[model samples]
Target: MTVAEIFPWQQVLWQQIRQPENLKRHHALLLKGRKGIGKLGFAFGLTQSVLCGQVDAAGVACGKCQDCYWFEQGLHPNFRLLEPEALSAPGGAAGKENEEGRVEAAGTKSGKKPSQQITIAQIRSLDDFIYLSAHQARDKVVLIHPAEAMNTAAANALLKKLEEPPEGVLFILVAHGASLIPATVLSRCRQIAMPAPEHKLARDWLVRQGITDPDFRLAISGFSPLLALQHDEQQSAPHADFIQSLCVPEKFDPIGLAEKLHKQDLSSVTSWLQKWCYDLMSSRISGRVRYHLQQADSIKRQAALMNPVAVGFMWRNLAASQQLARHPLNSRLFLEELFLTYGELIRPVGSETR
Candidate 1:
C-alpha cells in the first residue's frame, strides 16, 4: 500500500503542528476526528517534521535530509508507534518489539487472532522508551493510532504519562473521539480537530483514485471519502433486493426477510437495516436522505407515512440490535424478531390502532 505523507485536507492542521511556538509548549497532540479520515497518516507526517533536523521554510521534512531518509526507512531510533498487536505491522513502528526496546507481548503466540487492544502492558512498555535517552539526538516520538482501543486500565495508566510527559517526548494520539480518553489525559494534550474534507476537495481526491461513484460513496460514508472505499456502496444483485424491500417497511414478511438476510453476515445485515432506519429518521426531519441518495423520493414517501416519534423508537431498536449483532444466536430468529418489531413501528397509516 502506498502511504501518503499527508492529504490536501490536512494542510492547516499540519501547519499547526509544525508551528514552533505550538510544538515547543505541547508534549502531546490529540489528533481527534471521524474514523478513517487519515489521522494516523497525519501523525506520521508530524513525526517526520519534528524529528527532521533540517526542515525548510514551510516546516516540511526535506526528503533529501539524513533524518528524512532514516524516518522513511522506519529506522529512526527516536520514533515509536503504539497500536494493538493485531493492528501493528512489521516496520510500521521503530522495529521488532524486542529490538526497539518495546515490550514483548506474550499474547501474540497464543495462535488466536491477535488482540484488538493496546493492553496496559503496551502502555507500560513506554516507560523504558520514553524515559530513555534519544538514540539519535532528536526528540522521541510515540505515535498511537485508534487510541480508543485502550481499555479502562490502560487509559488510567496513560493518564500519568500524559500529565507529566517526559521532556523531549512527543505523544501523538490518533482517535475518533476525544471523550474516549480520560479527562485528565485530555486536559494535558493539545487537541487538533480533523474535519472531513470539503465536498469538492474530497471529490477531486477520489477522482484521482479512479473511483466511479465518488459522490454516492462520499454521501454514504458520512463525507469521509477515504472511508468510502472501505464500504461496498454498490448495490449488487443480492443486496439490491434486500435494500428495496426496506423502503416498504409495512409490507415486510419477517420470516421471509429474516431467512434471506441471515444468509449474509450479521454485521452487514444490521448495518444496512440501521442505515435504512437512519435514512427514515433523516427524511422525517430534513426531507433528505444520506446513504440512500438514489432512493430519496421513496425514502420521503415512507417518511411521510411514519411519525418521527415512531421512527425514533425504531432507531433505538436498531441500535440495540447492532449491539447484540456479534452474538452467535440463531441468526434467522434474531432477524425475524427485529423485522417484526420494525414492521410494528413502520405500520401503514390505516394499520394504527384507534
Candidate 2:
C-alpha cells in the first residue's frame, strides 16, 4: 500500500515522513511500535514512496512509474529488505514476488535449524549495495524489519553502517521492541513512536474490514485493528473456545481442553492463556479486563469468588511459561499441567472436586 492508502490512524505519521525535504534530515529512521500495529508496513510504504520516480502530492508512489514497478515486482536494485529468511521467501511478506533465495525452498543444513535472525552475512552484503550509487538516482534504501531479530554480530555489523552511513542511503529499522536494539545502534537513529488509535477509531476500522463485533475483536487484539481482523478470520473459533473455558468455572474440562488445544500452535495458545490469566487478575482487582473486553462480566463474576493472590501467582507462572512456550517437549502434557493448575485455582468455592 502507498502512503496515501495507509490506514487512517497512520495518515498523520505518514505525512510527517512523506515530505522529501523532511526525510533528508535523517539517515536512519526507527519505526517503533507494538506488534500488529503495521510498523513494518508503514516503513515499506514510505520506502516505496520515497524511491518512486513519480509521486503524488501525498508522497504516494504512482504505480505507473518505473521505480514503482520495480518495487512492486521486488526487483529494485537500490532497495533491500532485511528480515528473517522465512519472511523473504517467495510467498513471504518481505518479497513474495522474489522467486530466488526463498529460505523454505532453499532448505537447511543437516541437523541444523533454519535461522529466524538477520545474520551478519546479510548485513555485510549491503556493503556492495550501499557503496554503489542508486540505480534510480534517488536513494539506496535498506529496510530491516523487527530489528530485534538481529543477533549481536549482525547488530554490530549494522551498527558500523549506521555509524558511518553513506550519502543518499536511508536505513529504516522497524522494531516492535526498541530496547532489543543495541544502544549504540539506537543512538544513531531517529525514533518515531507509533501509538495505537483510540478505541472507537480502532473498532470502526475493524468494522470497515467486515468484522462483526469489531469491539470484541479489537479488545482481543489489544486494540490493534490489523491484528483484530487477522484473529477474527484465522483464530476466532479456537480463541473463543479457550476464553470461554477459562471464564466459566463450571465448564472447566482440563483433560478434554488440554487435548483440544494440544494440536494448536503452542506459542499462540500460550499467549492466549497468559492474556486470559492476566484478565483474571485485572477483573479481580480493577473490575475490568484489558484483552478480553467481551469476557469482562464473566471474568469479574469468577474473579469475585477467586483469591486475588492466587490469581496473581498464576499470572506470573503464565508469564514465565510464555518465555519457553515454543520449546515444550510435549504440548498436550504442557497444556494438561497448565489447565490442571487453573482448575485448582477456580475449583468451586466449597467443593474439593475439579
Q: Write the per-residue lDDT of candidate 2 for residues 1-354, one digit (tens) a residue.
A: 222146778889888887767899999999888876666667778888878878889888787888878887778888988887756544343432111112233344453445668899999989989988778577889998768889999999999998888989999998877898999999999999986788888888877877778877777777777667667345668878898778668878999999988887666777787788788888877778899876789888888888889888988888777655657898899989988988888886788773
Give the top-scoring candidate (lDDT).
2
lDDT of 2 at 5: 41
How many pairs of residues collide in model 2?
Answer: 0
For each candidate, give its TM-score against the true structure. Answer: 0.85, 0.89
